[model samples]
Target: MYFGASASALQRLVEQLKLEAAVERIKVSQAAAELQQYCMQKACKDALLVGEPRSCALF
Candidate 1:
């Protein structure tokens, strides 16, 4: 009975870790997307400032 309880606890811990990792991955993905958007906007604005053509493919 003790061994069974230990196994159950270990399984729960593993599942919790997996959930935490998934959450972290989602957060990182969102941050990356936001950063990409900011970069694209900055690039387009810089191009306009320098009198370059506003042909940004990201937009």
Candidate 2:
């Protein structure tokens, strides 16, 4: 019974890792798109207002 529970826990861990990896990939893709947009636009003060804290703005 103990062995079975250990195996089941391992399986759950593996599945969670797979899901985390997929989430990471999605975030990277979104960041790439945001960066591309930031680059294509001007870096004027108006653009700086786009993202937040002002300084964190990409454009």
> Which run of 10 residues does model 1 get worst, by summed lDDT?
45-54
Q: Whose lDDT is greatest here?
A: 1
For candidate 1, write residues 16-47 as lDDT tens digits.
Answer: 98998887445878999999899887885676
Can you write out model 2's per-residue Cα lDDT over 1-59, one digit (the tens) per residue? 44657877988988998998887445878999999889767555454446545454355
lDDT of 1: 0.78
Candidate 1: lDDT of 13? 86
How do the predictions measure up, each by TM-score? 0.33, 0.33
After superposition, the stretches of candidate 2 with alpha carbons farther than 4 Å from their true spots are 1-5, 24-59
Segments in model 1 whose C-alpha atoms lie over 4 Å from true places: 1-5, 25-59
Clashes of each: 0, 0
Model 2 TM-score is 0.33
